[model samples]
Target: MMDQPNPVRVGHKGAKVSWRKSSYSGSNGDCVELAELGNSVALRDSKDRQGPVVSVGWRTMTTFVSALKGGHMGAGQA
Candidate 1:
Protein backbone atom coordinates (compact mmCIF):
# COMPACT_ATOMS: atom_id res chain seq x y z
CA MET A 1 0.00 0.00 0.00
CA MET A 2 1.15 3.55 -0.56
CA ASP A 3 2.05 5.70 2.42
CA GLN A 4 -0.10 8.74 2.93
CA PRO A 5 0.03 11.74 5.20
CA ASN A 6 -2.61 12.14 7.89
CA PRO A 7 -5.37 14.58 6.94
CA VAL A 8 -5.63 17.83 8.83
CA ARG A 9 -8.77 19.78 9.60
CA VAL A 10 -9.41 23.08 7.86
CA GLY A 11 -9.61 25.23 10.93
CA HIS A 12 -8.60 28.82 11.36
CA LYS A 13 -5.43 28.00 9.48
CA GLY A 14 -7.41 27.42 6.28
CA ALA A 15 -10.51 29.47 6.99
CA LYS A 16 -9.63 31.78 4.16
CA VAL A 17 -8.08 29.35 1.73
CA SER A 18 -8.38 30.45 -1.89
CA TRP A 19 -9.53 27.38 -3.71
CA ARG A 20 -9.26 27.00 -7.50
CA LYS A 21 -10.61 24.39 -9.88
CA SER A 22 -8.56 22.87 -12.67
CA SER A 23 -9.25 24.18 -16.15
CA TYR A 24 -9.56 20.61 -17.32
CA SER A 25 -12.67 20.11 -15.25
CA GLY A 26 -15.84 19.84 -17.30
CA SER A 27 -19.30 21.16 -16.60
CA ASN A 28 -20.29 17.75 -15.28
CA GLY A 29 -19.41 18.94 -11.79
CA ASP A 30 -17.10 16.03 -11.10
CA CYS A 31 -14.23 18.23 -10.10
CA VAL A 32 -12.37 19.22 -7.00
CA GLU A 33 -10.91 22.49 -5.81
CA LEU A 34 -7.42 22.94 -4.37
CA ALA A 35 -6.04 25.54 -2.03
CA GLU A 36 -2.51 26.21 -0.89
CA LEU A 37 -2.06 26.74 2.80
CA GLY A 38 1.60 27.49 3.28
CA ASN A 39 3.39 24.14 3.66
CA SER A 40 0.17 22.21 3.28
CA VAL A 41 -2.52 21.88 0.61
CA ALA A 42 -6.29 21.63 0.93
CA LEU A 43 -8.73 19.88 -1.37
CA ARG A 44 -12.51 19.85 -1.48
CA ASP A 45 -15.22 18.88 -3.88
CA SER A 46 -16.12 21.75 -6.14
CA LYS A 47 -19.77 20.83 -6.15
CA ASP A 48 -19.80 20.90 -2.40
CA ARG A 49 -17.72 23.90 -1.54
CA GLN A 50 -18.72 23.84 2.11
CA GLY A 51 -18.21 20.13 2.46
CA PRO A 52 -15.35 18.20 4.01
CA VAL A 53 -11.79 19.09 3.10
CA VAL A 54 -8.64 17.02 2.98
CA SER A 55 -5.35 18.55 3.98
CA VAL A 56 -1.89 17.16 3.32
CA GLY A 57 1.67 18.37 3.20
CA TRP A 58 2.77 20.23 0.06
CA ARG A 59 5.41 17.58 -0.75
CA THR A 60 2.88 14.78 -0.36
CA MET A 61 0.41 16.58 -2.60
CA THR A 62 3.06 17.12 -5.29
CA THR A 63 4.18 13.50 -5.12
CA PHE A 64 0.61 12.30 -5.39
CA VAL A 65 0.02 14.47 -8.46
CA SER A 66 3.21 13.16 -10.06
CA ALA A 67 2.14 9.60 -9.40
CA LEU A 68 -1.24 10.23 -10.94
CA LYS A 69 0.33 11.86 -13.99
CA GLY A 70 2.69 8.90 -14.42
CA GLY A 71 -0.18 6.41 -14.03
CA HIS A 72 1.52 4.96 -10.98
CA MET A 73 -1.67 5.16 -8.93
CA GLY A 74 -4.88 3.33 -9.66
CA ALA A 75 -7.56 1.03 -8.25
CA GLY A 76 -5.00 -1.69 -7.48
CA GLN A 77 -1.32 -2.67 -7.93
CA ALA A 78 -0.18 -0.52 -5.10
Candidate 2:
Protein backbone atom coordinates (compact mmCIF):
# COMPACT_ATOMS: atom_id res chain seq x y z
CA MET A 1 0.00 0.00 0.00
CA MET A 2 1.15 3.54 -0.74
CA ASP A 3 1.59 6.00 2.09
CA GLN A 4 -1.05 8.71 2.09
CA PRO A 5 -0.15 12.32 2.60
CA ASN A 6 -0.69 13.66 6.09
CA PRO A 7 -3.45 16.17 6.76
CA VAL A 8 -1.11 18.28 8.81
CA ARG A 9 2.29 19.64 7.71
CA VAL A 10 4.04 22.46 9.47
CA GLY A 11 6.15 24.97 7.57
CA HIS A 12 9.77 25.21 8.55
CA LYS A 13 12.65 27.56 7.73
CA GLY A 14 10.41 30.60 7.23
CA ALA A 15 8.47 29.58 4.15
CA LYS A 16 6.32 32.32 2.64
CA VAL A 17 2.60 31.62 2.77
CA SER A 18 -0.52 33.54 1.85
CA TRP A 19 -3.52 32.87 4.06
CA ARG A 20 -7.16 33.56 3.22
CA LYS A 21 -10.44 33.24 5.14
CA SER A 22 -13.71 31.81 3.93
CA SER A 23 -16.18 34.32 2.51
CA TYR A 24 -19.06 32.61 4.32
CA SER A 25 -17.38 33.32 7.63
CA GLY A 26 -19.21 35.67 9.96
CA SER A 27 -17.85 39.02 10.98
CA ASN A 28 -18.59 38.35 14.66
CA GLY A 29 -15.90 35.64 14.77
CA ASP A 30 -15.38 31.84 14.57
CA CYS A 31 -14.31 30.73 11.13
CA VAL A 32 -11.84 28.59 9.24
CA GLU A 33 -9.17 29.94 6.94
CA LEU A 34 -7.51 28.37 3.88
CA ALA A 35 -4.35 28.96 1.96
CA GLU A 36 -3.51 27.46 -1.39
CA LEU A 37 0.16 26.82 -1.87
CA GLY A 38 1.08 24.88 -4.98
CA ASN A 39 -0.77 21.54 -5.04
CA SER A 40 -1.42 21.68 -1.27
CA VAL A 41 -4.13 23.40 0.75
CA ALA A 42 -3.61 24.72 4.25
CA LEU A 43 -6.31 25.07 6.91
CA ARG A 44 -6.20 27.13 10.08
CA ASP A 45 -8.51 28.56 12.71
CA SER A 46 -9.62 32.13 12.20
CA LYS A 47 -9.49 32.91 15.89
CA ASP A 48 -5.97 31.59 16.27
CA ARG A 49 -3.78 32.85 13.46
CA GLN A 50 -0.64 31.35 14.92
CA GLY A 51 -2.22 27.97 15.54
CA PRO A 52 -1.36 24.65 13.93
CA VAL A 53 -1.85 24.20 10.18
CA VAL A 54 -3.37 21.20 8.43
CA SER A 55 -2.24 20.59 4.86
CA VAL A 56 -4.24 18.59 2.33
CA GLY A 57 -4.41 18.03 -1.40
CA TRP A 58 -6.46 20.30 -3.65
CA ARG A 59 -8.80 17.51 -4.67
CA THR A 60 -9.27 16.36 -1.09
CA MET A 61 -9.90 19.89 0.03
CA THR A 62 -12.52 20.37 -2.68
CA THR A 63 -14.29 17.20 -1.67
CA PHE A 64 -14.27 18.12 2.00
CA VAL A 65 -15.61 21.61 1.31
CA SER A 66 -18.31 20.24 -0.95
CA ALA A 67 -19.34 17.72 1.69
CA LEU A 68 -19.46 20.48 4.28
CA LYS A 69 -21.69 22.64 2.10
CA GLY A 70 -23.87 19.67 1.18
CA GLY A 71 -24.35 18.86 4.88
CA HIS A 72 -23.10 15.34 4.39
CA MET A 73 -20.77 15.60 7.35
CA GLY A 74 -22.94 16.37 10.33
CA ALA A 75 -21.82 17.52 13.74
CA GLY A 76 -21.06 15.12 16.63
CA GLN A 77 -19.99 12.41 14.24
CA ALA A 78 -16.69 11.22 12.86
Candidate 3:
Protein backbone atom coordinates (compact mmCIF):
# COMPACT_ATOMS: atom_id res chain seq x y z
CA MET A 1 0.00 0.00 0.00
CA MET A 2 1.18 3.51 -0.75
CA ASP A 3 1.26 6.15 1.95
CA GLN A 4 -1.06 9.04 1.41
CA PRO A 5 0.30 12.54 1.61
CA ASN A 6 -0.70 14.75 4.52
CA PRO A 7 -3.31 17.32 3.68
CA VAL A 8 -2.40 21.00 3.85
CA ARG A 9 -4.89 22.52 6.24
CA VAL A 10 -3.56 25.97 6.89
CA GLY A 11 -6.09 28.10 5.07
CA HIS A 12 -9.86 27.99 5.38
CA LYS A 13 -12.47 27.76 2.68
CA GLY A 14 -13.09 30.93 0.68
CA ALA A 15 -10.01 32.66 2.08
CA LYS A 16 -8.76 35.61 0.08
CA VAL A 17 -5.47 34.62 -1.51
CA SER A 18 -3.46 36.06 -4.32
CA TRP A 19 -3.24 33.10 -6.69
CA ARG A 20 -1.51 32.82 -10.04
CA LYS A 21 -2.11 30.00 -12.46
CA SER A 22 0.55 28.48 -14.62
CA SER A 23 1.17 30.12 -17.98
CA TYR A 24 1.06 26.76 -19.72
CA SER A 25 -2.43 26.28 -18.32
CA GLY A 26 -3.67 28.30 -21.36
CA SER A 27 -7.06 30.02 -21.66
CA ASN A 28 -8.94 26.80 -20.94
CA GLY A 29 -8.41 27.77 -17.28
CA ASP A 30 -8.27 24.20 -16.06
CA CYS A 31 -5.25 24.71 -13.90
CA VAL A 32 -4.05 25.09 -10.30
CA GLU A 33 -3.30 28.47 -8.79
CA LEU A 34 -0.54 29.22 -6.26
CA ALA A 35 0.02 32.02 -3.80
CA GLU A 36 2.88 33.03 -1.54
CA LEU A 37 1.94 33.71 2.06
CA GLY A 38 4.96 34.59 4.16
CA ASN A 39 6.60 31.23 4.95
CA SER A 40 3.85 29.22 3.33
CA VAL A 41 2.48 28.77 -0.16
CA ALA A 42 -1.18 28.30 -0.94
CA LEU A 43 -2.74 26.36 -3.78
CA ARG A 44 -6.26 26.34 -5.16
CA ASP A 45 -7.99 25.26 -8.33
CA SER A 46 -8.31 27.89 -11.00
CA LYS A 47 -11.82 26.71 -11.77
CA ASP A 48 -12.69 27.31 -8.12
CA ARG A 49 -10.52 30.23 -7.14
CA GLN A 50 -12.89 31.22 -4.36
CA GLY A 51 -13.01 27.71 -2.96
CA PRO A 52 -10.87 25.92 -0.42
CA VAL A 53 -7.15 26.66 -0.35
CA VAL A 54 -4.27 24.46 0.77
CA SER A 55 -1.34 26.10 2.45
CA VAL A 56 2.03 24.41 2.87
CA GLY A 57 5.45 25.53 3.87
CA TRP A 58 7.61 27.09 1.16
CA ARG A 59 10.05 24.19 1.33
CA THR A 60 7.26 21.68 0.96
CA MET A 61 5.80 23.57 -1.98
CA THR A 62 9.17 23.65 -3.72
CA THR A 63 9.66 19.97 -3.10
CA PHE A 64 6.28 19.19 -4.59
CA VAL A 65 7.04 21.30 -7.64
CA SER A 66 10.40 19.58 -8.07
CA ALA A 67 8.77 16.17 -7.90
CA LEU A 68 6.21 17.21 -10.48
CA LYS A 69 8.92 18.46 -12.83
CA GLY A 70 10.87 15.26 -12.30
CA GLY A 71 7.81 13.16 -13.18
CA HIS A 72 7.65 11.64 -9.76
CA MET A 73 3.99 12.55 -9.54
CA GLY A 74 1.07 13.04 -11.93
CA ALA A 75 -1.37 15.85 -12.58
CA GLY A 76 -4.22 13.33 -12.45
CA GLN A 77 -6.00 15.14 -15.27
CA ALA A 78 -6.85 14.25 -18.84
**TM-scores for candidates 1 onward, in order:** 0.77, 0.73, 0.68
lDDT by residue (1-78, candidate 1, tens digit) is 444655555656546667899998899999988888887888888887768888788778888999988988883465
Per-residue lDDT of candidate 3, residues 1-78 (tens digit): 322334464356876556677878878767888877787777788787557767677777778789989888865756
lDDT of 2 by residue, 3-57 (tens): 2456565566788777788777788888888888798888888888777777878
Which candidate, 1 or 3, has the higher TM-score?
1
Against the true structure, what is every candidate's RMSD? 3.7, 3.5, 4.7
- Winner of 2 and 3 under TM-score: 2
Question: Can you give the lDDT of residue 53 in candidate 1?
Answer: 83
List ranges where model 3 is wrong by over 4 Å: 1-16, 74-78
- Enumerate residue pairs that collide in model 2: none
Query: Model 2: residues >4 Å from true position, as ranges?
Result: 1-11, 75-78
